[model samples]
Target: MNYYDGSFGGMHLIWWILWFFFIAWIFFIPADIPYQKSKKESPLDILKKRFAQGEISKEEFNEAKTIINSAT
Candidate 1:
């Protein structure tokens, strides 16, 4: 009805360390996973993407880019 063998050879301590390390990683990692929307792109970057994707005309892109640059 007991578990302690008195000779774990540090395995028990290693398990505790690994458990804490996993918890730290879960909380501290940024999770920069793609398609997860973990990162936010700046306005200019979004505008560039729009232009490249043909979602906006060249002149429109230029105007928006100018506005974003001046605002910053």
Candidate 2:
């Protein structure tokens, strides 16, 4: 049976400090990081924006609308 004596107080203090840091890291760290902004956007909103910017022709927009409707 062996045990550390009180004479090594500095070593004990360092051990305590390390243990405190380890526990703090385990218990206080967040599991999921928060997003700055939402990434979710409805498909309709994207289609409307594209249509308004004249990026797609009316036929293409209707095709996209049909695809979106079918997907949902």
Candidate 3:
């Protein structure tokens, strides 16, 4: 019968692999659905859209734009 030494080299490798997977899971997995912003719309673009949709008048849009510019 052969006596085995209690070396932990294999266990160390497994622990390292598990740690890597844990970190990868944290980065890649989202806890909720992700939100995406429209690529085409700036603040001005959205204001124009609201005007076009008759949600606001051109005068109101200009007034809002002035307020937004002042706030920035």
Candidate 4:
């Protein structure tokens, strides 16, 4: 076997395989650009929504809001 044409010091095509993954990482964007804005519901806002939906009465909503605000 010729030494110059051998499998890169007996390693079978390692450089090509490494380059393939390196180039792929540059284009992968699941955690990068075009970020998604997350909507965080505040305690008071959530209480108001529940009251509007009839999940809780006005007195209950006011009680919960006062408790939440006093705690903070």
* Top candidate (TM-score): 4
Worst 10 residues of 3 by lDDT: 32-41
Tell me the lDDT of candidate 1.
0.88
Q: Candidates' TM-scores?
A: 0.47, 0.47, 0.40, 0.52
lDDT of 3 by residue, 1-72 (tens): 755576767878899999999999999987766685446767877887898999998889999899878887
**Alpha carbon lDDT at 49, candidate 2:** 94
Model 4 has how many clashing residue pairs?
A: 0
Query: Which digits, one per residue and each the tens of the lDDT, describe model 1 over residues 1-72?
Result: 877677766878899999999999899987686468656798988899999999999999989988888999
Q: Model-by-model lDDT, in order?
A: 0.88, 0.89, 0.84, 0.81
Off by over 4 Å in 1: 1-37
lDDT of candidate 2 over 1-72, digit per residue (tens):
757665768878899999999999999886767565657779988998999999999999999999999999
Candidate ranking (TM-score, best to worst): 4, 1, 2, 3
Of candidate 2, the 10-residue stretch with the lowest lDDT total is 30-39
Sort every candidate by lDDT, greatest first.
2, 1, 3, 4
Model 2 lDDT, residue 2, Cα: 57
Q: After superposition, how far is residue 21 of candidate 3 from its true place, in Å?
A: 11
Q: Which stretches of model 4 miss by more than 4 angstroms?
A: 1-33
Global local distance difference test of model 2: 0.89
